[model samples]
Every structure is written in structure tokens, then in C-alpha cells.
Target: MAAVRTNGERTVNRLAIVSVLIITMIFLAPIYWIASTAFKPRNLATTIPPTIVFTPEISPFVKLFTKRSQLRAPPSQEEYEAAPWWERLVFDGGEKVVRSGRGEVQLSGYPSRFMNSLIVAITSTVLAVGMGTFTAYGFSRFKVKGEDDLLFFILSTRMLPPVVVAIPMFLMYRAVGLNDTHLGLIILYTAFNLSFAVWLMKGFIDEIPKEYEEAALVDGYTRMQAFFKIVLPEAATGIAATAVFCFITAWNEYAFALIMTNRRAQTAPPFIPSQVGSGLPDWTVIASGTLLFLLPVAIFTFLLRNHLLRGMSFGAIRK
Candidate 1:
């Protein structure tokens, strides 16, 4: 009986390992493909049997720089046709060139879109995290009538589909002369992120002992002082996690961003797809831009991974 049970346990452990390996590979496949494509030459990028490994090429980087100059010069129809395939691939008049295998690559849209995304994400995160921290503190400390119900209602707002409110928001923004503006997008992202921040922070704040704040108060620290000096320090892990979540959501947000902003303030998400024109999308450029776009999120997550794990493991351990 004992031998049979041991064999069964070993079999279960083997199955678990196999399951994890399969799931990990499934999740990593897209990232591997993107990284592979980013370094591949344009001709090899779309090749059959899918080029998994190749020598790094700098031609894509070179073309990215030169394509804009070529685009500005009006090519005669005959001259355009006579131009090298790479040049023709890169420049398509006013249409956005998604990818180019020719002369030098143009990168105007990517840089601008990246900057816009950074501005929106950073501003929104700061506003959401700052405001949510204070609001969460209030909810954690005060026992107002219907406070639980109020908290539930606040969380419910996040559950409502963003698309449902998008039209109303668009109309409201237009009425206030805020449409297609940086402030408009920032405000929208902040509001959306605020609900999650408040809820997550409130839970973290609640986990902190009240005695710490009481002791600080008895020692002459004001309520605000106690909060900043005691409670906030203890909750740093949760706050870091919340801030990362807020920033990522704001950074990757697309539907609202697409509907809200045009050429001047568009972000990386919408910008990438919109660049594809009458021909093949610029695979190399897109791959390069995607790799760049994902870099910050990857760094942020990696840096705060421990804090994120602790935050999510809330209430699982006593001490």
C-alpha cells in the first residue's frame, strides 16, 4: 500500500512539471517571436519555415533614418517605379509607412507616439496614486455610515465597461473644449486608474495595525503626519504594486486613446496599427518599436516583482 502511494505521488509531481512547462512555453511564444523578428532582416522576417535565428542587421536602423528624406522629395511615377524595392517599400507618399526594407527607415510617428504615451502614463499614474492614497487612508481610518457600501459602489465603477462610458465622455470633453487634448486623456486615465488604486490601497492600509498610528498621535504627531510617517512606510510594498498597475493600464490603453486623440497626442498603441497603409506593414520597424514599447513595462515589473508578489499575497500570512 505504501509503495503504491509513493508511485502515485511521483506520477502527480511529474504531471505537474509537465503542465507548467507547457503553459510557460505557450505564454513565452509571442515574446520569443517578437524578439526574433526585431533582429531579423526584412527579407528574412517573413520567410517561410520562419527564420528563428539570424545575424543581426543594421540596415533596418539605417533605413529608419533615411526614409523621411526620401518621402519629402516627390518621386515622379516613373522614378518611383525605377527606385530600388527597399526605397519603394519604405516611402508611400502621405500614407503611413508601417515597415520599410529600403534606403533609410523613417521613425517620426514612433518617437512622437512614444513621448505622448509616456506623458499620459506618468501624469495619470501620479494623479491616480496620489489621490487614491489619501482616499484609501480616509476609508481605512473612518467609519462613516454606509462606508462599506460606498466602497463597493466605488469599485463597481471599474467593473462598468469603459466603452459604455466612452461616448458620454467624448461628448462631455467636447462640451468643455477638452477633446483631443493631453489633459483630456490624462484626466480619463486618472479616473479609470483611481478606482483600482483606491481599492487596492484601502485593503493594504486596513492590514496595517491601528496601534502604530495611535502611538504616533500620542507622541504629538498630527493625523497627517502619522499617516505619512507610519502608515505609508508600512504599506510601501502595496503602493509600489498599485502604482505599477496604474502606469501599465494607462500606458497600454488604446480604445479611449484612439477615440480621444488624433495626430498630435496619439499614443503608441493606436499609432502602431494606424501606420499600416496600402502595402505590407513595416515589420522590422513595428518589431523595433514594439520591443522599445515593452521595455519600460518589463523593467518596472521586474524591479517591483517582490513587492507585487507580497501585495497579492495579502492576508495569506500572519507575520
Candidate 2:
């Protein structure tokens, strides 16, 4: 009987492992496809059977960052041999890099658009999370008038899809001459994320003991000092989790970014798809842009993975 029980346990464990592996593969497949396509040569990107294996090329990434035009004619043998490796990749793809008169390469808009995404996403995330932490600390540690009602009101903002407000928001942004500025998107994302940040942070703050702050006060620390010294440290896990969520929201934001900003402050989310030129769209370039776009959020989350794990389970159990 004991031997049979052990066998059953082993069977269950094996099944669990198999289930997890299957789920992981399912989730990772599209990401793998994108990464693979990003390195595929241009002609192989959209093949009927989907080429899974090929000689990887960095040309797509190069083309993604450079302005290029169709080659009028094949490069002379000397020209081909003399060109730099990246320029050779472009030349092989039947396109020539657009160059300035002084012989400098003219870059595409992707790099600036990528930078705009970083600036807006990172800045707004910080603002939202910072402001939310303070507001949440107040709610968690102090008595406020109509606290429940106020909390409900704050959460209400998230109940509606933000895109629903796109039209009015666009009009307002235009009226203020903020239609294509980084600050405008920053403010919008910060506001959109604030309610969520506050609520999430409040939970984490509530989990912390007020006794720590009281002890700090007894030690001659002011409320601000106690908050910075005691409460903030205890709530670090929650803050990391909230920051990740807020950053991703701001990073992947599309409709608002599309309508709110044009050339000056356009983010990667809106700019990547618009890379389709006059001919058949270059899927390789698009894929490369998308793969690069995925990196910042992935890295941010990976760095905070420990905190995120703890944050998710932080308040789930009580002594």
C-alpha cells in the first residue's frame, strides 16, 4: 500500500511538471516567433510554411534604425566590397541607405520614438507611483473624512476604459497646445495610473504595522522621517509591484499615444506599425522594432522579479 501511494505521488508530480511546461511553452511561443522573425532575412520573413531555421541576419535591425530607399541598380563589385558590413546587409536586401551629402547616414525616426517611449513611460511611472505611495500612506495610516467614499471614487476611474475618453481628451490636449509634447503624455499617463497605484499601494501600506511608525515617533523622528525610514522600506515590495504595472501600462499605451502625439513625442507602440512603406510591408523590420520594444519592460520586470513575487503574496496570509 505504501509503495502504491508513493507511485501515485510521483505520478501527480510528473503531471504537474508537464502541465507547467506546456503552459510555459504556450505563452512563450509568440515571443519566440517574434524574436526569430526579427533576425530572419527579409525574403524569409513571410514564407508560406514559416521558416523556423535560417541564417540570422542583423540587417532587419539595421534597416529598422536607418532611412532607406530602393536601390536604383546593383552596387558595383568594388562598391559592394568596400561598403561596411551593415551597409552590405541593407544592400543585399535591395535597398540603399539614405545618406547625407557629406556622406553621413541618415537615421530613421525609430530611435527618437524609442527614446520618447522610455522618457514618457519611466517618468510617468515614477510620478504615479510616488504620488500614489504618499496618498496611500495617508489613507492607510490616518483617518480621512468619507474615506470609503473617497476610495470608491478613486477606484471608479479605473472602471472605465481610458480609450473611451479619447475624443474629449484629444480636444482638451489640442486646446492647451499640448498635442505633440512629452509632458502632455506624461501627465495623461500619470493621471490614468494614479488611481490604480493608490489603491494597490494602500493595501501594502495597510499590511505594515503602525507600531513601527509609533516607535519611530518615540525615537524623535518626525512623521516624514518615520515614513521614509520605516514605512517605505516595509512597503518596498508593493512599490516595486506597483511600479512595474504602471510602467507597463504607460509603455504599451496605444490609443492615447496615437491621438495625443505625432512626430515629436510619438512612442514605439504607435511608430512601429507605421513603418510599412509603399511596397509590401517589411515584416522583418516591424518584427525587429517590436522585439526591441519588448526589452525595457522585460528587463524592468526581471530586475524586480523577487520583489514582485513577494508583493503578490505579501498580504495573502495573516498571523
Q: Evaluated with TM-score, which candidate comes out highest?
A: 2
lDDT of 2 by residue, 114-207 (tens): 9999999999999999999999999999999999999888877766776887788889988989888999999999988898789888888998
The parts of candidate 2 lying over 4 Å away from their true place are 1-9, 277-279, 304-319
Task: Output the TM-score of candidate 2.
Answer: 0.90
Q: Candidate 1 lDDT, tens digit per residue, 248-307?
A: 889999999989998788899988777676687768767877877888988988887766
Q: TM-scores of all models? A: 0.81, 0.90
lDDT of each: 0.79, 0.88
